[model samples]
Target: MLLVPLVYLVIALAQVQAGAYAAQSTAIDAARQAARQPEGAAARAQALGELHFADHGLESARWTVELSCSGDCARAGSRVTAAVEARVPVPGVPQIWGGAHVPGITVRAEHTDVVSPEES
Candidate 1:
Protein backbone atom coordinates (compact mmCIF):
# COMPACT_ATOMS: atom_id res chain seq x y z
CA MET A 1 0.00 0.00 0.00
CA LEU A 2 1.08 3.61 0.61
CA LEU A 3 3.47 2.44 3.33
CA VAL A 4 5.49 0.34 0.89
CA PRO A 5 6.23 3.24 -1.40
CA LEU A 6 7.07 5.42 1.59
CA VAL A 7 9.54 2.85 2.87
CA TYR A 8 11.18 2.63 -0.52
CA LEU A 9 11.46 6.41 -0.66
CA VAL A 10 13.13 6.46 2.72
CA ILE A 11 15.60 3.80 1.65
CA ALA A 12 16.47 5.68 -1.52
CA LEU A 13 16.99 8.89 0.43
CA ALA A 14 19.22 7.18 2.95
CA GLN A 15 21.32 5.62 0.21
CA VAL A 16 21.72 8.98 -1.50
CA GLN A 17 22.77 10.60 1.77
CA ALA A 18 25.33 7.91 2.42
CA GLY A 19 26.68 8.23 -1.11
CA ALA A 20 27.00 11.99 -0.75
CA TYR A 21 28.92 11.68 2.50
CA ALA A 22 31.21 9.07 0.99
CA ALA A 23 31.90 11.18 -2.08
CA GLN A 24 32.78 14.18 0.09
CA SER A 25 35.13 12.18 2.28
CA THR A 26 36.74 10.57 -0.74
CA ALA A 27 37.37 13.95 -2.36
CA ILE A 28 38.92 15.34 0.80
CA ASP A 29 41.12 12.33 1.35
CA ALA A 30 42.23 12.22 -2.29
CA ALA A 31 43.09 15.90 -2.35
CA ARG A 32 45.12 15.63 0.82
CA GLN A 33 46.95 12.58 -0.47
CA ALA A 34 47.70 14.19 -3.80
CA ALA A 35 48.97 17.33 -2.11
CA ARG A 36 51.48 15.27 -0.17
CA GLN A 37 52.92 13.54 -3.20
CA PRO A 38 56.03 14.80 -4.98
CA GLU A 39 54.90 14.45 -8.60
CA GLY A 40 51.79 14.37 -10.71
CA ALA A 41 51.89 10.65 -11.42
CA ALA A 42 52.48 9.80 -7.82
CA ALA A 43 49.80 12.17 -6.71
CA ARG A 44 47.23 10.61 -9.00
CA ALA A 45 48.17 7.16 -7.87
CA GLN A 46 47.86 8.09 -4.24
CA ALA A 47 44.55 9.80 -4.83
CA LEU A 48 43.10 6.82 -6.67
CA GLY A 49 44.04 4.61 -3.77
CA GLU A 50 42.03 6.76 -1.40
CA LEU A 51 38.78 6.35 -3.27
CA HIS A 52 37.01 3.83 -1.05
CA PHE A 53 33.26 3.21 -1.36
CA ALA A 54 32.59 -0.26 0.03
CA ASP A 55 32.53 0.83 3.64
CA HIS A 56 29.97 3.54 2.91
CA GLY A 57 27.31 1.22 1.46
CA LEU A 58 28.31 2.30 -2.05
CA GLU A 59 29.94 -0.92 -3.05
CA SER A 60 27.64 -1.28 -6.04
CA ALA A 61 27.65 2.41 -6.94
CA ARG A 62 29.42 3.72 -9.99
CA TRP A 63 32.04 6.25 -8.91
CA THR A 64 35.02 8.07 -10.31
CA VAL A 65 37.52 10.72 -9.27
CA GLU A 66 39.15 13.49 -11.23
CA LEU A 67 42.22 15.45 -10.17
CA SER A 68 43.43 18.88 -11.24
CA CYS A 69 46.28 21.14 -10.28
CA SER A 70 46.56 24.91 -10.13
CA GLY A 71 50.00 24.68 -11.71
CA ASP A 72 52.88 22.27 -11.45
CA CYS A 73 51.69 19.69 -8.99
CA ALA A 74 55.17 19.12 -7.57
CA ARG A 75 55.81 22.80 -6.97
CA ALA A 76 55.41 24.22 -3.50
CA GLY A 77 52.34 26.35 -2.83
CA SER A 78 50.45 24.83 -5.77
CA ARG A 79 46.98 23.55 -5.18
CA VAL A 80 45.69 20.07 -5.91
CA THR A 81 41.98 19.51 -6.41
CA ALA A 82 40.09 16.26 -6.29
CA ALA A 83 36.54 15.81 -7.55
CA VAL A 84 34.50 12.72 -6.84
CA GLU A 85 31.28 11.64 -8.51
CA ALA A 86 29.02 8.77 -7.56
CA ARG A 87 25.86 7.39 -9.12
CA VAL A 88 23.81 5.52 -6.56
CA PRO A 89 20.94 3.41 -7.77
CA VAL A 90 17.59 3.89 -6.07
CA PRO A 91 16.53 0.92 -4.01
CA GLY A 92 13.37 -1.15 -4.66
CA VAL A 93 13.22 0.11 -8.23
CA PRO A 94 12.84 -2.30 -11.10
CA GLN A 95 15.57 -2.10 -13.72
CA ILE A 96 12.92 -1.93 -16.39
CA TRP A 97 9.38 -0.86 -15.83
CA GLY A 98 7.17 0.46 -18.67
CA GLY A 99 10.34 1.40 -20.56
CA ALA A 100 11.55 3.39 -17.58
CA HIS A 101 15.22 3.25 -16.80
CA VAL A 102 16.70 2.62 -13.40
CA PRO A 103 16.67 5.78 -11.33
CA GLY A 104 19.88 6.95 -9.70
CA ILE A 105 21.10 9.82 -7.59
CA THR A 106 24.24 11.59 -8.62
CA VAL A 107 26.46 12.73 -5.78
CA ARG A 108 29.46 14.93 -6.29
CA ALA A 109 32.12 16.54 -4.10
CA GLU A 110 35.32 18.52 -4.53
CA HIS A 111 38.24 19.37 -2.27
CA THR A 112 41.47 21.27 -2.71
CA ASP A 113 44.71 21.33 -0.76
CA VAL A 114 47.97 23.16 -1.15
CA VAL A 115 51.02 21.14 -2.03
CA SER A 116 53.30 20.98 0.95
CA PRO A 117 56.62 22.77 0.66
CA GLU A 118 58.44 19.84 2.18
CA GLU A 119 57.24 17.54 -0.56
CA SER A 120 58.63 19.65 -3.38
Candidate 2:
Protein backbone atom coordinates (compact mmCIF):
# COMPACT_ATOMS: atom_id res chain seq x y z
CA MET A 1 0.00 0.00 0.00
CA LEU A 2 2.81 2.40 0.83
CA LEU A 3 4.23 1.86 -2.64
CA VAL A 4 1.01 3.14 -4.17
CA PRO A 5 1.43 6.56 -2.64
CA LEU A 6 5.04 6.67 -3.70
CA VAL A 7 3.99 5.88 -7.24
CA TYR A 8 1.56 8.75 -7.20
CA LEU A 9 4.25 11.10 -6.00
CA VAL A 10 6.59 9.99 -8.74
CA ILE A 11 3.92 10.50 -11.38
CA ALA A 12 3.12 13.96 -10.08
CA LEU A 13 6.76 14.95 -10.14
CA ALA A 14 7.13 13.68 -13.66
CA GLN A 15 4.17 15.77 -14.76
CA VAL A 16 5.75 18.88 -13.28
CA GLN A 17 9.02 18.18 -15.10
CA ALA A 18 7.16 17.73 -18.35
CA GLY A 19 5.31 20.99 -17.87
CA ALA A 20 8.58 22.81 -17.32
CA TYR A 21 10.01 21.42 -20.53
CA ALA A 22 6.92 22.50 -22.45
CA ALA A 23 7.13 25.99 -21.04
CA GLN A 24 10.75 26.28 -22.12
CA SER A 25 9.87 25.27 -25.66
CA THR A 26 7.03 27.79 -25.69
CA ALA A 27 9.37 30.57 -24.63
CA ILE A 28 11.87 29.73 -27.36
CA ASP A 29 9.15 29.81 -29.99
CA ALA A 30 7.86 33.14 -28.71
CA ALA A 31 11.31 34.62 -28.88
CA ARG A 32 11.85 33.43 -32.43
CA GLN A 33 8.52 34.84 -33.54
CA ALA A 34 9.17 38.15 -31.83
CA ALA A 35 12.59 38.48 -33.40
CA ARG A 36 11.02 38.29 -36.81
CA GLN A 37 8.79 41.32 -36.16
CA PRO A 38 9.68 44.99 -36.17
CA GLU A 39 10.95 46.51 -32.95
CA GLY A 40 7.91 48.14 -31.39
CA ALA A 41 4.68 47.52 -29.53
CA ALA A 42 3.46 45.35 -32.36
CA ALA A 43 6.39 43.02 -31.93
CA ARG A 44 5.83 42.76 -28.22
CA ALA A 45 2.15 42.07 -28.68
CA GLN A 46 2.95 39.41 -31.22
CA ALA A 47 5.35 37.73 -28.83
CA LEU A 48 2.84 37.77 -26.00
CA GLY A 49 0.23 36.34 -28.28
CA GLU A 50 2.55 33.50 -29.16
CA LEU A 51 3.22 32.85 -25.52
CA HIS A 52 -0.48 32.74 -24.78
CA PHE A 53 -1.00 30.31 -27.59
CA ALA A 54 1.82 28.06 -26.42
CA ASP A 55 1.10 28.10 -22.70
CA HIS A 56 1.11 24.56 -21.39
CA GLY A 57 -1.80 24.53 -18.97
CA LEU A 58 -0.15 27.32 -17.02
CA GLU A 59 -1.95 30.39 -15.64
CA SER A 60 -1.22 33.45 -17.75
CA ALA A 61 -1.21 35.69 -14.71
CA ARG A 62 1.67 33.73 -13.25
CA TRP A 63 3.81 34.12 -16.36
CA THR A 64 6.26 36.96 -17.01
CA VAL A 65 7.74 37.70 -20.42
CA GLU A 66 10.46 40.15 -21.35
CA LEU A 67 11.78 41.13 -24.78
CA SER A 68 14.96 43.05 -25.41
CA CYS A 69 17.36 43.93 -28.17
CA SER A 70 21.07 44.64 -28.17
CA GLY A 71 23.27 46.43 -30.72
CA ASP A 72 21.69 47.98 -33.79
CA CYS A 73 18.42 46.17 -33.43
CA ALA A 74 17.23 47.20 -36.87
CA ARG A 75 20.44 45.98 -38.48
CA ALA A 76 20.84 42.50 -39.87
CA GLY A 77 23.51 41.56 -37.34
CA SER A 78 21.51 42.66 -34.31
CA ARG A 79 19.93 40.23 -31.85
CA VAL A 80 16.60 40.07 -30.07
CA THR A 81 16.16 38.24 -26.81
CA ALA A 82 13.08 36.90 -25.09
CA ALA A 83 12.86 35.73 -21.50
CA VAL A 84 9.90 33.87 -20.01
CA GLU A 85 9.35 32.90 -16.40
CA ALA A 86 6.40 31.16 -14.80
CA ARG A 87 5.35 29.46 -11.62
CA VAL A 88 3.55 26.26 -12.48
CA PRO A 89 1.32 24.56 -9.93
CA VAL A 90 2.15 20.94 -9.40
CA PRO A 91 -0.67 18.53 -10.08
CA GLY A 92 -0.42 16.07 -7.31
CA VAL A 93 -2.68 13.45 -5.86
CA PRO A 94 -5.24 14.67 -3.34
CA GLN A 95 -3.83 15.40 0.07
CA ILE A 96 -6.81 13.77 1.69
CA TRP A 97 -5.62 10.56 0.14
CA GLY A 98 -2.31 10.75 2.06
CA GLY A 99 -0.44 12.55 -0.66
CA ALA A 100 2.38 14.93 0.10
CA HIS A 101 1.92 18.69 -0.16
CA VAL A 102 4.13 19.59 -3.07
CA PRO A 103 4.81 23.23 -3.72
CA GLY A 104 4.87 24.70 -7.21
CA ILE A 105 8.00 25.07 -9.33
CA THR A 106 9.36 28.00 -11.26
CA VAL A 107 10.48 27.53 -14.84
CA ARG A 108 12.28 29.97 -17.09
CA ALA A 109 13.61 30.08 -20.65
CA GLU A 110 15.45 32.62 -22.77
CA HIS A 111 16.30 32.70 -26.44
CA THR A 112 18.09 35.07 -28.77
CA ASP A 113 17.42 35.41 -32.47
CA VAL A 114 19.17 37.49 -35.07
CA VAL A 115 17.22 40.20 -36.84
CA SER A 116 17.37 40.81 -40.57
CA PRO A 117 17.86 44.43 -41.54
CA GLU A 118 15.45 43.99 -44.39
CA GLU A 119 12.66 43.09 -41.98
CA SER A 120 10.64 46.01 -40.73
Scored by lDDT, the top model is 1
lDDT of each: 0.78, 0.62
* Residue ranges of candidate 1 with Cα displaced over 4 Å: 38-51, 96-101
Report the lDDT tens digits of candidate 2 across residue range 25-54: 656766676666644734564456455635
Give the range where candidate 2 is weakest over 10 consecutive residues by summed lDDT.
93-102
lDDT of 1 by residue, 14-116 (tens): 9999898888888888888888864564455334534567667677777788888999988889998888888888876677753235678898999999997
Per-model TM-score, in order, reads 0.81, 0.67
